[model samples]
Structures are given as C-alpha cells and as structure tokens.
Target: MKELRYLNKYFKKYWFKLLIGIIITIIARVFSLVLPPYVNKSIRAVEGYVASGSGDLSAVKGELLEYILIILGAALLSGFFTFLMRQTIINVSRYIEYDLKNEIYDHYQRLNLGFYKQNRTGDLMNRISEDVNQVRLYCGPAIMYSIQTLTLFFCLVPIMFIKAPTLALYTLLPLPILSVLIYRISRVIHKRSTIVQQFLSTLSTFTQESFSGISVIKAYGLEPKTNANLQTLAIEGKDKSMDLARVNAWFSPLMILLIGISNIFVIYIGGKQYIDGQIESMGIIAEFIIYVNMLTWPVAVVGWLTSIVQRAEASQKRINEFLHVQPEIKNEIDKDTPIAGRIEFKNVTFTYPDTNITALRNISFTVKEGETVAFIGRIGSGKSTILDLVARLYDINSGELLIDGMPIKKLNLKNLRGAIGAVPQDAFLFSDTISNNIRFGKENASMEEIVTMAKKAVVHENITGFTKGYDTVLGERGITLSGGQKQRVSIARALLKDPQIYLFDDCLSAVDTETEEEILNNLKQASKNKTTLIVSHRVSSAKNADKIIVLEDGQILQEGTHDQLVGREGYYKELYQHQLSEN
Candidate 1:
C-alpha cells in the first residue's frame, strides 16, 4: 500500500471520472436493491389474496403484473448504470497505464550508459510490459470491483436488518470470520505473488538473451546446452506459478463454504421466526435469502482483488527502483549554446564506472576549431576515451574539459551532442532499411543526401548492388552486411549529420587499403573546415592528418606531423616503416 501511494496523482488526475463512476455505482446498487423488496411484495400479494378467499383473480393478476414490470424496469436501469460505471472508471485506468508506460520509457532514455551496463535488457522490457500491466490491473479491475463490492454491502445489508434483525444478524455472522480468513490468506498470497513476478522477470531475461544471441549459439554448436538451460528456467517458473495458483485455489471454495453456512442459517432461523409469527410473512424470509445470496459474489471476489493489489504493489516497487535513479550525467545549462568545436582536455583523468578500470590518466590535448587531428595507438591505449570525453559521455575524475571555451558540463548536453558526428569503433545499425539507418543521423535528410553520403563513405556500390539498393532492410546490428560495409554505412550516417565536430573511431578497420584510401580522400573533402578526430591503428588512416598523436597505455607518447614522426626513430617511424614494407 505504501508503494501503491505513488498512484495517487493518477487517481487525482482522473478524479472527475472516478466521482461520476462512484455516483453511478451507488445508483446502480440502489436500483438492484429494488428487486428483493418488490419480490417480497409480489409474494405478499399472493398470500393476502389467498387468505381473503375472495373470487377476484383479475385484481390479483393485475397487481402481480405491476410488481413484475417494476422489477424488470429496475433491472434494466441498474444494468445501464453498471455499464457506464465501467466505461468511466475502467477507461481512466487505461489512460493512466498509457501515461505510466510513456513515463518509464522517457526515464529510460535519460538514464546513463552505466545504468544499462548494470541492468539486463530483458528485465527492463519486463518492467515496462509485464510489471506495468500488473499495475494496470490495480488501477482498473481491482479498483472497480472493490467499489462495486462496497456499494453492494452498504446498500443491501441495512435493508435485511430492518426487515428482520434477528435473521439478518445470524445471516451476517459468517462475514467476520470470512474477513479474518481473507487477511491470513492474503499474507501468503502477497509472498507467493512476489516470488512469481521475480521468476517471470528471470524467465523473460533468459528468453530475450537467447533469441538475441541465437547466431552465436548456433555457431558454437551449443544449441543443446541452450535448450536444456531454458527448460530448467521454464520448470522453475512453472513451479512458482503453481505455488501461487494453489493458494488462489483456496479462495473460491472457502467463500462458497462460508456463504453456504449463512444460507443454511437463513433457512433454519428464518423458518422458526416465521412459524413463531415474529416475521410478518414468508416474503421476509424470501427477501433475506435474496440479500444474502447477493453478497456471495462480492465476498468471493475479495480474494481476487487482494491478489491483484498484491501483484501490482510488487510490480510498482520494481518500477520505482529505476525511476528513483538520477542520471550520472546532467546538463548544467538549459539554454542552447552554439558549438565551434574547439575541444580541450587539461590533465584529464577518467575511470570506467562499471569495471573500475582507469581508461585515461592525466591525458592532455587540444583540437582547435577546424583542425583535423588523428590519434593512433595500440588497443586499450585511451584513444577512444578521448573522443568519449569530448562528447561528454562521462565526466573526468580530475581536470578541465572544455567545448568552445566553455566547461563541457556548462554547455547544454543536447546542443553539444547535436553538434558532433561520431562513428564509434563498433559500427551499430538498427534493424531497419539502409536508407532509414542513414536517415537516423538526420531525420529530415532527403534521399539524394543519403545516397551522396553513402557514396562518400565508399559503400554506395555495395548498396546499389543489392536488389533493393538503399531500400534493403538489414538484420540485427546490420549483420546482413559485411563488416566493411557496416562500417561504411555507419560512416555515411555520421557524414549525413554534417556536424561541426567529426569523430571517426577506427571506422575503416575492416576495409582493404585501396578502399580505405578512397574513403579517406572523400572524408578529407567532406570534413573540410570542421574539427575531426580519427582514432585508428593503421598508419595510412592517420598519415594525411594535419597533426598525429601517438598514444600508449592511457597517455600520449608523441605529437607531430606524419612526416616529422616518420623521419624519427620511435613508434610512428617504426609503424610507418613496417606498413611501408607491407605495402
């Protein structure tokens, strides 16, 4: 219930609709209450006529027909209001469900990369889908049913007591005992429902991962192993669900047994009262029977409502865990600040949050506006980390990081990121058409612009060779294309952005030297008058840059023009010599 308090705002949001629904619910119950009394009158009319022993069948028939018509009219009106009650209240719940899912999705977009590294994709999906759905049940069906039950009890109970106090008292005796049993059973249900929800998340996670990595599983010939593992998880999930079902099974029969006892008390006690003339007529006994049975469904539904609420509370708790987390990175400035791409890092140090590995140490560099600087290094040499820092993906542990002479954090994050076109080391493409994938970098880009950028990245030929050309849809992560083709497509995507700062992180690693040289030439032209940082291992990739920095073990080792470094006897000259020999 404490967790469920979070939904108060939504309830407040749709308060008017809920109020109308409540009014309608009460009115419907009142009309439904008309049936039992009218039934009593119809029975009494027959009894009085029989006692009179008069020759007047037409009078009795007319009176009986009037009562029957009134009963039918009340039933029709009650049914109509009940329908409106659901339309008003249940629709509000759906509206809340829509709002909640959007809220969760927006929060997901704001969360930092570190949060994703610590969480599983399947669990995230489950929270938005399964968990949110559970909460919806609480918002709609559980709430609606609870209201219906309460209204029925309040309206029906008093009438029974006023008609025959002794009989009503005995008939309601089982209710208190039913309540105590529900409380005890509900505790067990809450515990079991939590366990079932958790197992569902685990199962969803396992299934999602298996499908996403199906290629890896097949390639490694581990299909049997994967199948066996999934079977194990499925078995565990089934056992947990059954545990919950077994407890729920108790609710229906328990309700029936208790309500049946109330019915028996009605028969035995109401008969005695009628025989002793304490009751007016057999109609009172008949009315009491109808009222007691009316209570049966609502009382029976209590267990279901409790189960829904318990499941919802568990799901909301999971949603709140992520909702409460503040993003690791936030923009200090809200206003849009234009970027000129003068990136500077002074004594910057950075550590990866998830792994606790220091990726950069006292790294220092500057790329003035419109300068093309290339960073060449061995693997894990902090080349990519420099690019990440400039993009403000992670703040440094110690030192100044500036973009356009402003502290990186002081610039609006959206404006700063928008001004940069970054092609990461591992080129990732969504499961979409090639044209749409390129258009992702610039949403409103024209078809001609996409083809132009694709040509510049040296992937145009491969794309046109396909049957659908740019219209060809790709598989997951662009697995449909070759590695070189994927990298070229990613390059085309960045080029389409046409940003002030271009960061190409070893994007040509898979291409042959001939194609690499051609792409480099095209990039050199496309990136004119823009600050560019190319992080690559190949000498040919960096040789034409205005300035080249050699990095080793999280620190810069050399900074010079390609000719200057090639003339000297260090890593650059050795690499140039080695590559020159291979060529």
Candidate 2:
C-alpha cells in the first residue's frame, strides 16, 4: 500500500493531462449510456402500436429514423473522446517511466563498491527494465479502464433503480460474492507474482555470470555441465511463472460465471413481474438487459485489473527499496586545499562488510611527496586493499587516513580522486575504439598525448599493428587483445591523466620479465616528481624503491629498502629466497 504512493509524485507532475483524460473518458461512457435508453424508448413505441390495433407504421418509422441519427452522432462523439483519453494518459505514462528510469540509474551511480559486492548485476538490470515496465502498465491502461468502469457503474445504477427497483435489487445481489472472491484471489495473486519476479532475477543473474565466463567454461570442456546448470535455472523460473498463471486461470472465468448469474436473475425477475401484469411495459426489460450487458465486461475484468494493480505495487516496492538505500560513502562539502601527493596511514584497520576477517590491521605507514614505494606480499596480503583505500573506495574502519595533512574523509570525493591515477588489478576496457579507451583517463586528452603515453607504456607498437590502429573497436572486456596488451593499454590510460599520485595494483603481472623491466624503466623517468605506489609480487620490482613494506595477514610484517630486507630473518627474507631459487 505504501509502495503505491510512489506513483503520486508522477501523477502530480502530469495532473493536467490526467484530469483531461478522465473527463474525456467520462464523456464517452455517458454517451454510451444514452444509447440504451433510446433502445427502451423505441421498443415501448412498438409495444403501444400493437396494443392499440393500429397497423400504421409511419409514426414508428419517423421516430426510429430520428433516434437512429441521434445515436449515430452520439457514437461518433464517444469514439473521438476515447481516442483523446488514450493519447493523453498513455503518453504521460511514457514520460513518467523515462523520469523514473533516469532516477534509478543516477542512484546506482552514487552507490559504493561495497553495495555492488553484495548485489548482482543482472538483478539490478531486471529491476530497471522489467520492474519499471510493470509500474508503467498500472499507470496507463489500468488507470484508464478503472476510471471508465467506475464512471459507467455510477451512471447506470441510478437509471436501473428508477426503472424497476425490485428488479435492480435482484440483479445486484450476486455482486457481493464476486467482490469477496476477487479480494481473496488478489492476495494470492500478489504473493505469487512477487515470487515469479524474484525467480526471474535469479535466472538473469545466472545467465549473465555464465556468459561472462564462457571462455573458461569452454576451456574446461564443460559445455554439457554448463548447459545443464542453465536449464536448471530456466526450469525454476518457468515453474514460478506457471504458478502465477494457474492462479490467473481460476480468476477470469469465475468472474464471468458470477456476471452470468447476475444477468439470469435480471431476466427471470423482470419476466415474472410482466406475466403478473405488475410491470408497465416490456420495453423496460429490454433496457435493463442492455444495461446489464454493458456492466458484464467491466465486472468480469475486476480480477484482471486487480492483478495489474497488485503487480505494480510489488514492483514499486522493489524500486523504492533500491532508491532509498543510503550510500556508505557520502561526498563532503570540503574546503579548497591543494593535494601535495603525500599519503599517511595512522594505525588504520578495516574489515569488509558481512565478514569477520580484517583485511587491513594497524597498517601505519607514510609515503612522502615525490617518493616511489612498492609493497611486496603474497596473494591476499592486503596489497590491493591498501590501494583501494587511497581511492576512498571503502572507508577505513578505524584510525585516520590523510592526504596532505587533511583527513581523507573530509576531502571532496571528486577532487581527491582527480589527483590520483589508478590502474586496477583487472585491466577493464570499454567496448570502444582503442583511442577512446585511452582518452577515458583524460577527458580532453589530445591524440598526440595519447600516442606519447602509449609509447611510454610500451603499447604503441601493438596498437599500430592492428588493422584500424587506434581506431580499432574492442570486444567486451577488451577480449580482442591479449592479457599483456590490455595491461599496457591500461597503463597508457593512467599515464595520460598526469595526476599528482599514481597507484598500480599488480598491473604488470601479465607482461613478461623483459617487457616488465622495459616498462618499469620508462615509468622511473616519467614518475620522478609524483608519489608512486606499486603493489608487486616480484622482489626485483621493489628492490630499487625508497621503501619496501612487506604485508602478511593484514599486518605490516617488515618495512625497509629491498637490500635492507633481503638478509633479514622474516617472511620477506623467506619469500625473496624462494623467488631467487625459482629463477
């Protein structure tokens, strides 16, 4: 019920159009109501002629022609108003849908990485596409028909009572039973529809994950197994859909049966009164039958219309839940303070959401302005997590993180992120031209700058080898290129930004030893005056750094230059000896 209130905001925005549409709908129904009364009038005249034993048909013909023309004109007006009503209301529904979609998309952009980790991509996609469409259905045809049905009911009921009150009572007696049946069925329908939607989301999520990992599936020769898994999800979704459909099957026909019973009562009671000579004319019976027939369709659709309304309410609730979630990180209104490329971590600790393990603990360190530092540790040693914190991807659980002596939390998000150039562990690329992917780092970067950065990152020669060169369009996730090529392009993009600070999270892992040495040599010259932090597994990468911090189990186990740590009796010495022996 509360979720239905979300539509009130959209309704207010297009109230004028909605008001006009309702008025036109009422006018159309009223015109339709007029034709039934004319039918009653014509029949009564014919009855009178038969009773008086007059065979003259001239008067009847004249009256019939006059009323026929009137009814025809009324029919024309009714159709024109109906067209106007649909045009206004349906167009308003589309506009409201557009606004709602944009609102949801914008909210998604503001959410942090932690939120994304907890929710699946396909579920979010379904919420925006399918769920939004459900609400739009309620806004358009459902509202139009509901207004039309109610207007006709109010107009027809009074006339029916005036013609024959006792007959009217008999005709309406079955309606209360129909009402109760619809009310009970609607609750079940709502529950079943929600389950169907949730299963649809699960299916979407499974399909997306499967396709994204199709290469791995094929590599392992898992086609049959993968297909079986997909089929399992598909069947689950189908079962939910069948459950909802089964409920709807019982709803429509039952409503029609009730309406049929109401019609039978009208005919029996009116005929009995006529036979007893208590009714004035048989024409009233004809009019009553016409009115009851008119009421039949609207009455029958009560369950169907209620199904639409219930589905919309369920969808609105889902959208509302997503929109109302407050992001863990909020952008602050920070004072203008110049970033000096200095980072300080003071006894910081962080634990990921919904997890008991601490990812980083008591990790006190400082990277002074214009210094190059490297972190060498095993997998899951908080190396990437530390870089993630620098970007403020997730806030620290305790202690202070500072950028140029100012608390990182108090800094403007845009300003802070703008000062750093980051190359994540996964070298993600958009499905776009090679040049466009490089230009993403610097929105207004020139072609010459792109080439220069690419050359420095050792990827220019590879780009030139492609048929379209920099104009080549990439496939999804840059699948067109090899892993090492993707890494070089990612490095080139970060270099083009020319930021005050640089963070590379194991970016050179895909490159061979010779190429990695060449790229690192170039980086040494390019990043002389900037603060650079590199997370690497190779001790050779950190041997030249001003400082090397060895992390183990979320704690800083050792901190010194590479030579100072090589002979020490600690985890760093053991790792160095292993790598040295492996080579």
Candidate 3:
C-alpha cells in the first residue's frame, strides 16, 4: 500500500472523471434495487386479486403488465449506467498507465551507466511492460468492482434490515468469517505474487540473453544445453504460476459457499416467520430473495478484486525499488558549459564501481587542445580507460580531471560528453539503414556529408557496392557488415560528429595493414587541429603521433617520439624491431 501511494498524484490528475464514475456506479446500483421492490409489489397484487374470488381479473392483468414494464426499464437503465462506469474509470486507468511508463522511461534515461551494469536489459523491460500491466488491473478493474460491491452493500443491505432485521442479522452472520478468509488468502497471494514476478524477470533475462547470443551458441555447438536450460526455467516459472493460481482458486468457492449459507438463513427464517403469521405474506420473502440475489455477483467479485490488488502491490513494490534509487552521477550545474578539449589527468586514480577493480592508479598526463597522442601497451594497461574518463562515462575516484583548466565534474555533463566523438573497441550499430547509422552522430547530417565521412573512414566504397547502397539496412549490431567494415562504419560515425576531441580505441585493429595505412593517412588529414587520443597495440598506429606513451600494467613505461623511442633500447624499441622484421 505504501508503494502504491506513488500513484496518488495520478488519482488527483483525473479526480473529476473518477467522481463521475462513482456517481454512475451508485446510480446503477440504485436502479438495480428497483426490480426487487417491484417483485414484492407484484406478488402482493397477485395475492390480493386471488383473494378477491379470482374474478374480473382484467384490472389485475393490466397492473401486472405495468409492473413488468417498469422492471424492464429499470434493468435497461442499470445496464447503461454500468457501461458508462466502466468506460470512464477504465480509460483513466489507461491514462495513468501511459504516464507511469513514460515516467519510468525518463528516470531510466537519467540513471548512470553503473546502474545498467548491475541490471539486466530484460528485467528493465519487464518492469516497464509486465509489471505496469499488473498495476493497471488494480487501477481499473479492481477499483471499479470494489466500488460496485460497496455501492450494492450500502444501498441494498439497509433496506433488508429495515424490513426484516432479525432475518438480515441471521443472513449476514457468515460475512465476518468470509472477511477473515479473505485476509488470510490475500497474505498468501501477496507472497506468491512477488515470487512469480521475480521468476518472470529471471525467465526474461535468460531468454533475452539466449536470443542475443544465438550465433555464439550455434558456433560453440551448445544448442542442446541451451534448450535444456530454457526448459528448466520454464518448468520453474510454471510451478510458481500454479502456486499463485492455487491460492486464487480458494476465493470463488469460498464466496459461493458463504452466499449459499446466507440463502439458507433467508429461506428457513422467512418460512418460519410466515407460518407464525409474524410476516404478512410470501411477498416479503420474495423481495428478500431478490435482494440477496442482486448482491450475489458483487460479493463474489470481492475475492477477485482482492487478488488483483495483492498482485498489483507486489509488482509496484518491485518497480518502486528501482524508482526510489537516486542516480550516482548528478548534474550539479544547470547550464551548458562549452568544451575546449584540453584534457589533463592530474594524479588520477580510478576504480570501477561494480567490480571494484582499480583500472588506473595515480595516473597523470596532459593532452593539449590540438595534439594527437597515441598510447601503446599490453592488455590491461589502462589504455581504453583513459578515453572513458575523457568522455566522463565514469568519474574518477581521487584525481583532478580538468578540461580546459576546469574540473570536469563542474562542467555540464551533457555538454562535456557532446563535444567528444568516441569509437570503442567493440563497434556497436543499431538495426537501421547504413545512412541512418552514420547520421546518428549528427541527426541532421546531409547525404553529401555522410559520403564524405564514409570516404574518409575508407568505407564508402564498401557501402556503394551493395545493391541498396546507402539505404541498405543492417542487422542487429550491424551484423550484416564484416568485422573490418563494422569498425570503419563506427569510425565514419565519429568522423561525422566533427567534435573538438576524438577518442579512437583500437578501432582500426580489424582492418588490413594496407587499408589501415590509408585510413591513418585520411585520419591525419581529418584530425589536423582536433585533440585526438588513439589507443592501439600496433607500433604503426603510434609512429605518426606527436607523442607516443608506452604503458605496462597501469603505469607509463616510455613517453617520447617514435625516433627517440626506436633509437633507445626499451620495450618500444624491441617491439619496433619485431614488427619491422615481420613486415
């Protein structure tokens, strides 16, 4: 219930419609009560007519026809108002559902990268889709039925007591027991519902991962193992669903049993009172029977409404768990601050939040506003991590990371990241057209500009060779393209951005040596006055940089020009000799 309080603002937003719906529900219940009173009157009329020697029955026949018409009109009005009630309240629920999803999505966008690392994509999707759907049931059907149930009780039960208090008392004796049953059953439902939702998230994550890695599964010949795993998850999910269903099964039968007990009280007591001449006629008993039946459906639905509410609360609690989390990175400044790209890491130390792995330790370096610096190192030498810091995908632990002489954290996060064009070692592209993928860097980029950037990245020829040319649609993650072509497309995307700084993290690793040489020449012409950072294991990529920094195990091993490093006897020199001999 506390978690569900989050939706109070929405209730306020649509209060007028809810008020109308409540009025309509009450009117509908009132209309339905008309039939029982008419039944009582008709039966009394018949008793009187029969007592009048059963002659000259024309007056009685006309009166009976008139009563039937009134009953029919009341039934029609009740049905119409019931439809209106559903339309208003149910539509409000849909509106609330739409707003809730948008709020969750916007909050998701605000969350930092670390959050995504800790959560699975499928689980996130489930919260937004499946969990929200369950909550909608509570908002719409649960609320509507609850109102209808209450309206019937308030409008009909009082009349029963006014007419026959003793009979009413006996009839309602089973209700308190029914209430206790509902309370106990609802507790079980809440517990089982939480477990079921967790199972859904687990199953969703497994299936998503399987689909995304289908290629890897096939290549490794693990289809049988994957199938077996999925089957196991499905069985477990089914068992959990059955557990919830078993609890729900108690509700309807319990409602029916209690309603039956109430009817027995009505018949036995009404019959006894009539025999004692304490009741005037069978008409009173007939009226009481009609009232009891009118209440039957609404009471039966109480169990269902409780189930819906319990399940909704369970799902909403899960949603609130993520919604309440404040993002680790906050935008302190409200205005955008322009970037100049003079990046300096003053004794920087950084550790990844999720794994607590220290990627950089007391690292210090400076890249001038328009200098191309190359970092060459073995694996785990903190080469790519340098680019990540420059983009502020993560904030450093204990260091002064300055951009253009100001603390990077003080700068507007969006503006700082916007000024840099980064190409990661893993080139990711969406499932879209080739032109659209390139245009992602610059949303309004023209076809001519796209062609120019593609040519500069040495990928335009490959694109034009396709039958669809620039319009060719890529598969997921640009799977339609070769590894080298994917890297080139990613490079083309960055080139299209034309930002103040470029961070290329081994993007040319997949390209052939000849193509890599040509692409490097094109990049030299393209990155003339832009600060660029190139991270690669190849000496060739580092040879043309203004300064090459060699790293080993998170620390600088050598820092100098190509000639200076090749002339000296060090790691760079030995690597250079080995590459030269191989070439």
Cα miss at 232, model 3 (Å)? 1.5
Candidate 3 on 159-232: residue-level lDDT in tens? 98998898888888888898899999999999999999988999999999998898999999999999999999
Candidate 2: what lDDT? 0.88
Candidate 1 local lDDT, residue 483:
93
lDDT of each: 0.92, 0.88, 0.91
Clashes of each: 0, 0, 0
TM-score of 2: 0.90
Q: How much lDDT does candidate 3 score?
A: 0.91
Poorest stretch of ten by lDDT in candidate 3: 49-58
Per-residue lDDT of candidate 2, residues 1-583 (tens digit): 6798987999999999999989989998998887888887888788878888976799888888888888899999988888998999888889888989999999998898878888999999989999999999899888888988999889988888888999998888888988898898899989998888787788888888888888999999998998998898888888888988988898768867877887788789999999988788888888888888888888877777899988988888888989999988888856665677899999999998856568899889999999998998888889998998999988999999998888998888888888899998789999999999999999999999999999999999999999999999999899899999999999999999988999999999899888998999988888899999999998767777889999998899899988899868997788888888987
User: Tens-digit lDDT track for model 1 on 1-583?
Assistant: 8888888999999999988988888888878889989889999999999999984889989999999999999999999999998998889889999999999999998888889999999899999999999999999889888988999988778877888889989999999998998899899988998898888889889989988899899999999999999999989999999999999999999999999999999989999998898997899888888988889999999999988999999999889999999988887888889999898989998999999989888988889999999998888989998998888888889999988888999999999999999998789999999999999999999999999999999999999999999999999889899999999999999999999999999999999999999999999999999999999999999999999999988988999999999888899999888888999
Compute each candidate's TM-score over C-alphas.
0.97, 0.90, 0.93
Q: lDDT order of candidates, best first?
A: 1, 3, 2
- Sorting all predicted structures by TM-score, with the top scorer first, yields 1, 3, 2
Model 1 residue 12 lDDT score: 95
- How many pairs in model 3 have backbone atoms within 3 A of each other, for residues 3 or more apart or on separate chains, i.e. clashes? 0
